[model samples]
Target: MMLPLLEMTYKELADAFTEQYKKGPALAKALYGEFFKNLNPKAWQAEEIQASPGLADRLREDLSFSPGKIVDEIHQDGLTKFVTELADGVRIESVILPLKTHQTVCISSQVGCRMGCRFCETGKLGLARNLTVEEIIGQVYTARRRYGRSIRNVVFMGMGEPFDNFENVIQAVRVMSDQRGLNIAQRHITLSTAGRIDGIEKLAALNIPNLNLTVSLNAPNDDLRGRLMPIHNTVSMVRLQQALRAYPLKKGNWLSIVYVLIPDVNNGPEHARQLADWLQPLRAKVNLIPFNPGKNAPFRAPHETEIDSFRRQLIARQIQVQKRAPRGRDLMAACGQLGSGIRQQGLN
Candidate 1:
């Protein structure tokens, strides 16, 4: 059984090196640096590797660098969607969005999803399995390498509900934010959940610094929310709102509440007013996503006028809100548009 080098945090790698090779933290730091620099054992040229005889060879022999391979990639409208096939042949999709200044990578936390949100393509597949820490981090590394862009932001908003795969997702975040590794700042990482109260409470208890939390809150009340998101049946909107209010947010940082505007469903002005009232207790900004219809989508996207009206209603209520323009819809890379191909292929 080989240990995954990418799965270990800097401290864990350093401790392992100190315990097994009698090398201090300096050597471990150098090795860790080299591993992330090229993500290839053969590309290592750190001075520490040359100074310590057989150290590089020993690392290659002991540790495994298996981030899987990018099997498919698609580019459309400034968005790139890439699929990585794991060693076990399970495939997951990740997207790279071109931001104004820097790029952002959206990574998956699980293979498919169990939280059957009515608008999500991934939810239709049901739950396959949670991604490992290596698998989750591997998407970022592979995307960065292939796209050749500096990824300044990372969002757990690709395939599955992040909070459902809590441990692996958190471990991946720790490794990604470590200065010696991916070096992405904690503030740059965002974890989006489908309103899982247990996961919400667990994350609040962790109190991770500067980490952004987004809740997929499509509806304002329990009746409508339950129809849109099956998770609402287990965790009511009131309870979810209570958890969000209790979450420790840094100064000037507010939670993101994502509302998918499905036409004739939850896109009415009354719904917007109710949403504003629901959000009154928490520090949250609403991101209005005009529904991107997936294959056999139960509902159509709201018209531009309807979207504008909904935004106006929220604004009139003094709720901070922003309408997210649909991106990568042609490539099926937009919100609620991932996992259909995999599901159709019977991969899940």
Candidate 2:
């Protein structure tokens, strides 16, 4: 089987090159240092490499090449969403948000999700399969190539429960952040999970630097959370709390507790208070995400008055909290708004 060169970490790239070609690390560095930094498709065709003629062509042709093609695109309100088709014909959506100072790409780790979060459109599709490391990184590669600017940040917040596809996600992170590859700073990447406690424990044990973790704690208690998120059935709030407490974080840095405010569902003064009490023991900052409109979901976004009241309640309890303004809603590219049109196309 061919190695997905674009998805390999520096160590993996070097080791693979030596094992396959009987060459030293210099060849691997020479190839990746050029391709990753520039992302030029033509680089492999260059004739100046310290290798046999046609070697680059042979390597490119044989390997599982191409990061997938951008089959569809939607741009609105400064957010651009791209639908890419992978080699096996599976499709995924990636979003690019042009912030004031930088661009953030929300990439997916799976074709569809099985978590079955009531608010998420992705969950409605059910699980197809976990994305390979290359397929995950391919989103970033395609975005960078199309936009012609360096991607400043990336979020694993697009279409799947990241921790469910833990190994590929971690491998993709390493390759994307490698000094020889995309070189995205560890701090610039954020992995959001729907309270996957096992994944949280694994990440804590890794003790990687500058990589941020966010848990989608949409409910204040187990009963309400279980109704909203099916993962809560197995990974209870109490178990999730234990895992979060065990997570090693820098002393002042807090874990992001993402609470999607579903009107009349998980949004109330009592819910806010319970949330505050739940987070009191851990270092956490609550991010209040107003629910985005979804075709199948019955919930609605909380009123601004309710949102403010909820924030104030958490503030009164001395819990750090902030409201996340909705983005890319017009294009259905915002949080809980992805997974549109793929089912109709039968990619899942």
Candidate 3:
């Protein structure tokens, strides 16, 4: 089997290079550094490093460095969504969202999701399979190359439930944070999950520095949350709250609570108060996301006035809150809105 060079750690790659070519650490560093410069299979050039004839060719062929194939690309508004096809032909979507100062890429951890959140389009696809570390890292590399700018942030909010693919996601993040590779700071990465208490406990135990955690907490109480997210049936809101309270966070850092505001579902003033009360114990910032309209979705986006009123009600209780503006909805690439699609479209 060919070794996946892009999925390797600095030490692993360096050791492999040293062992393969009988070279010292110097050659290992040179070749390892080159591989990441472009992240292409042929990134390491022999003439540039004074390697023996055919050594670079051998290295490139012996160690497979290919990421996934880019099946299609679509740009909507300021966002560009890339459809990546893995070796098995399973496709996953990653979105490049351009903000005022920097760009953020939303990557998928799984090919499909099983959480079955009523508001999420991805959930409707059912669970396909969890992506390997190489597959997850491929999305970041693809986005950085296509966007022609450094990605400032990464969110595991694209397709599947990240926590379900815990090990691979963490390994990918480690490779991404390595200074030799993508070199993304831990603070710039955030992992969002649908109230998986066990996953939250594991993350807290790992104490991964600066990696932010966001809970897809759409409803304030158990009954409503269970109605919205079926996972709540197993891990109730109270259990999730207890886990969040126990989860370790850096000083002054707060967990992000995502409240998807559906028109008549969970957008009442009382809901806001209950949300505020629920979050009062734990340090958290609320991101009120109006439901993005989707195919056959049972809910509609709340009115602007209702969104404003909800934010105000939370603020009145001394909770930090912000209304998340919808992006890439036209392309079905916004929050809770990634499904299998192939037609290409772009927006200027």
Candidate 4:
């Protein structure tokens, strides 16, 4: 149990205030005061650093992503670890994916999820609530203390429907990209949505480079997309493709098309061809993921032969295709696997 006297980090302070005490603006201010008090006074005294405007902006703004957080165990194992909890019966999981090069924190944007997809564990719980900006960003600070370094990348693909929690999600993204704190480049960040039509437009307006905006495109046709993801029932593939084309994207920036290959479901070479045909016009890349099985998730991954066949088919058509290495599986860290501990402990 945390003592009332513990020197809480910015995130800890916010969680205590919003989730526990129910105060909003006042708690946000107090958290800011605490942050100002802890900032290192001797950070920017170097002569070369003072000469560059870009460097100054980085120091003052983009670096302030996760305030008042630290890694407790992220650095020791050189791998990610998560802490699961529930406030008012809503499941929340925080992840820190670590590597030799840099650490990345995967944070959730909502409790459970309203965008119920067939393959996601979080969505199965249904939507409880959209997390506040502070609640979303707090996970970063908590991971930092456990791990020991500022994370190099942030992927908003953890446990919730990031776009469904649009306003708060963007606010958290803004704070994370702020220069006054964590100076992470927006390019190094990624956001995945099941498929939210309006959210894609908003992201396009942000115009942040190398922001890997990904869509979970699991099917070749509307019928299949609707079957895999319930959101497609409303925002069909045809409409999603239209929204994606409207986005002002960089030349080389491809809208990452995430295809979860499940046995006999969406794992055939013909399905691959159909998908490629559907996406040939869009500036996009296909990331073939062998479905990560979760609790009560009926889907199973395709055979390696089937996966290779699909990848080759996409590549033959000159579509940029790559297979993403699944991470944190040992610790149940893949997408939709983060909340098992909470369930086991009866927290949610």
List the global CA lDDT of all models. Answer: 0.87, 0.84, 0.83, 0.67
lDDT of 1 by residue, 1-348 (tens): 354767888999888988888889998888888777665544235778768988767766777766788888899999999888898899999999998889999999999999888899999988889999999998988877777648879999999999888999999999999888888999999999988889989998998959999999999899999988988998787788889889999999999999999889998778987999999988899999999987778888788999999999999989999899998888999998888778888773
Every candidate's CA RMSD: 1.4, 1.8, 3.0, 9.1
Which whole-number lDDT from 0 to 100 does residue 158 have in model 2? 94
**How much is 166 displaced in model 3, in angstroms?**
0.4
* lDDT, residue 317, model 4: 83
Q: lDDT score of model 1? A: 0.87
Worst 10 residues of 2 by lDDT: 41-50
Clashing pairs in 2: none
TM-score of predicted model 4? 0.76
Which candidate leads the pack in TM-score? 1
Stretches of candidate 3 off by over 4 Å are 46-50, 340-348
In candidate 1, stretches whose alpha carbon ends up further than 4 angstroms from where it belongs are 41-45
Model 1 clash tally, residue pairs:
0
Candidate 3: C-alpha lDDT? 0.83
lDDT of 2 by residue, 153-270 (tens): 9999999989999999998999999988888888889999999888999999889857899999999899999999998988777888999888888766778989988888987788
Q: Tell me, by lDDT, which candidate is best.
A: 1
- Tens digit of per-residue lDDT, candidate 3, span 1-348: 456866877887768767776766666666666666565556557355555667666766777755788887898888888888888777888999887788999999987799989998888778888989988988888777778547868999998888999999999888888887778888999999998899999999999959999999999999999999999999776788899999899997889999898978898887887888899889899988989988666888788898898888889999999888887778888899876463222110
TM-score of each: 0.97, 0.95, 0.94, 0.76
